[model samples]
Target: MDEQIITGATAAEITASVRTLHERGALRPGDALPPVRELAALLGVNRNTAVAAYRLLAQAGVVVARGRAGTVIAGHEAVAQEGYAPDSVLRDIGTGNPDPRLIPDPTTALARATGRPVLYGEPVIDPALEDRALAWVRDDLPGRDLRITVTSGAVDAVERLLAQALLRDDAVALEDPCFLASIHTVRLGGYRAVPVPVDSEGMTVDGLRAALDDGVRAIICTPRAQNPTGATLSPRRAADLRALLAEHPYVLVIEDDHFSMLSQRPYETLIGPEHRRFALVRSVSKFLGPDMCLAIAATDPETAERLALRLSPGTTWVSHLLQRLVLAQLTDGTVLHAIAAAGRHYAERNAAFAAHLTERGLPTEAEDGLNLWVALPVAAKTVAERLVLRGWLARTGDEFVLSERSAPSHHLRLTVHDLTDEETARLIDDLAESTR
Candidate 1:
């Protein structure tokens, strides 16, 4: 065992020792440091002095007390030093991520817009943006009687809608292997999560019916470009889901159209006219830019009223500047042209990856959005681990699971945009070898 000989006669000495350990790469994110008692005994210092030092680190976001898990290094600082800049990695085949290179350059436009100071107590949603947004939303939701409200993002809209509609411990149905953000939000809000099964055609109607039978009060569905799987609800599937939902008219149904404009697949709205309470959330992050942090929540009057209550004047309204910036890009012909180019690029690149996988005798399906969901012959986790060993990071299907079930899936979500022909071929070869 290494000797921890910090002769700290004072609190300052203890603090300095802790800082030195962090600076010298002794501690890292998710690494639990020695307990205060152990440190105190090892360093020949008073327990209070060690405690104070730990507290100081915690206050400075250097460490976090995870209750039973003990104190661990807090954020990205340690990871950054370890060369774990998540965004800089090659071929990040993870979540429903959009290519940052495609987002229109906002520097010049934002600088010009910022010249005028935004006044306090002004309307949260820019009128010009609202008009355009309404038109955009109305396009797919044609002739549907709905109202629109803007939120920071789709997740925010989900949280607020749930808060307004459901109480703690009330059950909400979600897609099994659901989006991580939805899982986190539902669990954090003290709600019971009911899992609805998903297959290639999207959320299964039978599974949703079972969740409803379990007394769920709400359901969050993804109709197109379902994250992690890149699955869309086929027309037949959508009709079946609508039929299943018609029975539970009072239950709040939230369809997160997260892939909205970026989706290369034809738009299918799951909110059937007969369903009395529902909301359709479409986010601009995947198409415009994640930093834009804008989403339009269109809902029936009752849910809209409750959502509006949460967004009242000062509470949860998105910034007008962001709204204006998004509006500018949405209306600009040049920006629209860029978005069209991005769509084509994504479809072509993903198709190339699918072909590469097929050539290597690996099963793969190329779909809309910026990523590909390839089905491996072995377990997805095993494949992901093998990729990690080869210096490539990927997300496994298990991370998306929301229910208790056996039978492992062989699917791996991969972002293929940045990969060249050589890189794609290499990835396919490695994947085939890993499976074998």
Candidate 2:
């Protein structure tokens, strides 16, 4: 609270001073920061200098602007993450993972993946993998003259693409009910997230218009198997979005087709033929197993060059062995058949579960992707609590929503495809009773 404690002449210096203060316990969470004008006067600096300092602190999440209340220190908030609880005994049905049984065995492919050692100056992409990947993604892409770059996974690709193109505090359009990793990525990068609501047909046009109007520098889209909601972008909806995006041709568009291999729905691209500045990322995690962390990024020439800057030879390039393995499995007839069967298995299980809910007077639909989005008669939180008592752990739809106005979601995203018939029946009965 001492005016004497705050001392700095420049924005970066002021930010560092505040950080040191916080580290020393002088500026605790919820403590109000000095007003910009007052701080400028005290520190004998220009008003813009103080404003820039505050902006830096806000972007780092050390302080939050509270309108009339002014700015206050922000304590760490709980971030939603993927996978299961570390020590929970509850049967987790909300993990949102692919069924392990369906993932093809990698033993044979691993053995064949090894070859002569790649030197530091060799091309980053394996020649065979690059060739196969190009053919694989070419048909679905609307844009031409695309270049490919590989990354660890979809999350890594997105982070690099955004970092290359955006500055801290730049606005980015993200789906309201979004993928957990995507949400975390934007927040950690200090980017302002503009919420774009998603419907059964994928990201709504109105929501996107609002984000664009807000001046978002970049937009992240999921073309199919949109997480948490299992919504696929219809051809008509994709056309509509392309028309809207056509005007803003320079805004960086990053489309993550994370479930491309397993999606039952047709790929509908938002990128128009003439539109520039875009990247399409496809990860092998869903079908090839999550441990094999490799993804292919196809982008415009300029974007590709920007992204390449982050990847240094031998230091940051994706593992050549892993890339070869993925390509081999992808081209194998047996692996292809297994992937197809796995897709059907997920679809059938979700449909069966939806049918059960319909029979119980709670209508639900089996959409594409590994999970089923079910609407509950009561609050999803209440149902989840009841399910917890009945030995089930469920993910509430609220966790995926980006807007506070969309809180207290009544829907629950359930991944019951891997459950046995007995377990499925038990979950259905428990869900019905919980809703009541």
Candidate 3:
């Protein structure tokens, strides 16, 4: 790593030089960057200018700061996402997906989804869908300055909301044992994640207060049916969080209610009536199927305006057909009944499985989500390894943790709602054996 390769008079120029050097193979990943003072002296610039240059590069995902180790070149790595293993023979019980059998058939709604052709300059959201969504969303988010915007899904909406409000390197408070997509999005965007611990009552008050004290610009919370852990926010817990957040009135709050329709628990929120900034996102993927690729965001007027800037008029807006399809299914009597039945089915299956674990001396509770978070007597990694040997693939709770200082997770998140009675019994037996 020759200091001579880095030559520039200004911060932008220095950033460009490093990018060019990396492109030309002169600089590689893990290469050390010169310290701020040394680089400043070499370029005859102030130390602040040198620091700014490095910050720019870090924001671009081209470099990472390592404190005493100084700055180093960084390489992009593919993030793990939620889905089935492409060609694996093992039964995957870890993928956080809805049961396909429970998802209502979309074919019947396709014809109803068809309508008059929409032009480029027309409104982005379908009139019918918007009308239905407003009524439905209003029930949950009552009495606030609200506006509805659509995106590909809950993940897309969160990304857009963060992009609209945050700068690179800004801190965002995320739930520990977070949703996979949130972890991936924060890492890729080059933003810092502050871990806020979640218990049976969702985000803890002290954890959120700490994140706020750390000067997080934003917070992403799952109010109901939190992923991986299946934690829901109790009314008292929500009130405590809202009271704490009231002090930092301007910190943006984004609540993701991904299991809106399928959740058996009541919906509780972190946003206060007088809170200045927020977004509440609900996606149809859970009940309508993932391929539908549509979600509605109810956000503050200013936030909605800022988010709209990222979505171009004609090309980037969510498809009208998808919105119509969701609206049709939502309004249909038969589809609503089916969705309600599916919710009960998931609760019943998880309870049965939890009882099985309890009978075997491993105390467990059936939480209110599609997955069961099981605590093993031993390390979850040991059990996962044993499960793999027995033709079962499970996701360990360690993958969702935000900080290394947190205790080693002895938990596994299992999606076993779709499993038959015989299959469930076999899995319970295998889990018991694995712990031994």
Using all chains and alpha carbons, the TM-scores for the candidates as numbered come to 0.77, 0.94, 0.95
Q: Tens digits of per-residue lDDT for model 3 on 1-436?
A: 8898898999999999999999999999889999999999999998999999999998888998766878989867566678787788999999888899999998899899898888888888887887777887787778987888999999999999999998888899999989999999998888889999999999999999999999999999999889989999999999999999989989999999999889999999999988989999999999888998989999889998998888886889998888888888999999999999999999998999999999998888898889999998899999999999999999999888886654678999999999988889899999999998
Question: TM-score-based ranking, best first?
Answer: 3, 2, 1
Measured by TM-score, the strongest candidate is 3
Worst 10 residues of 1 by lDDT: 76-85
lDDT of 2 by residue, 87-177 (tens): 9999999999999999999988787788888889788899899888889878877449888999999999999999999987789999879
Q: Which residue pairs collide, candidate 2?
A: none
Each model's lDDT: 0.77, 0.91, 0.91
Span of ten consecutive residues with least summed lDDT in model 2: 399-408
What's the number of clashes in each of the models? 2, 0, 0
- All candidates: CA RMSD (Å): 9.9, 2.1, 1.9
Clashing pairs in 1: 93-415, 177-400
Q: Is candidate 1 or candidate 3 better by TM-score?
A: 3
Stretches off by above 4 angstroms in model 2 are 1-4, 8-13, 35-47, 59-70, 74-76
Winner on TM-score between 1 and 2 is 2
Candidate 1 deviant stretches above 4 angstroms:
1-91, 111-121
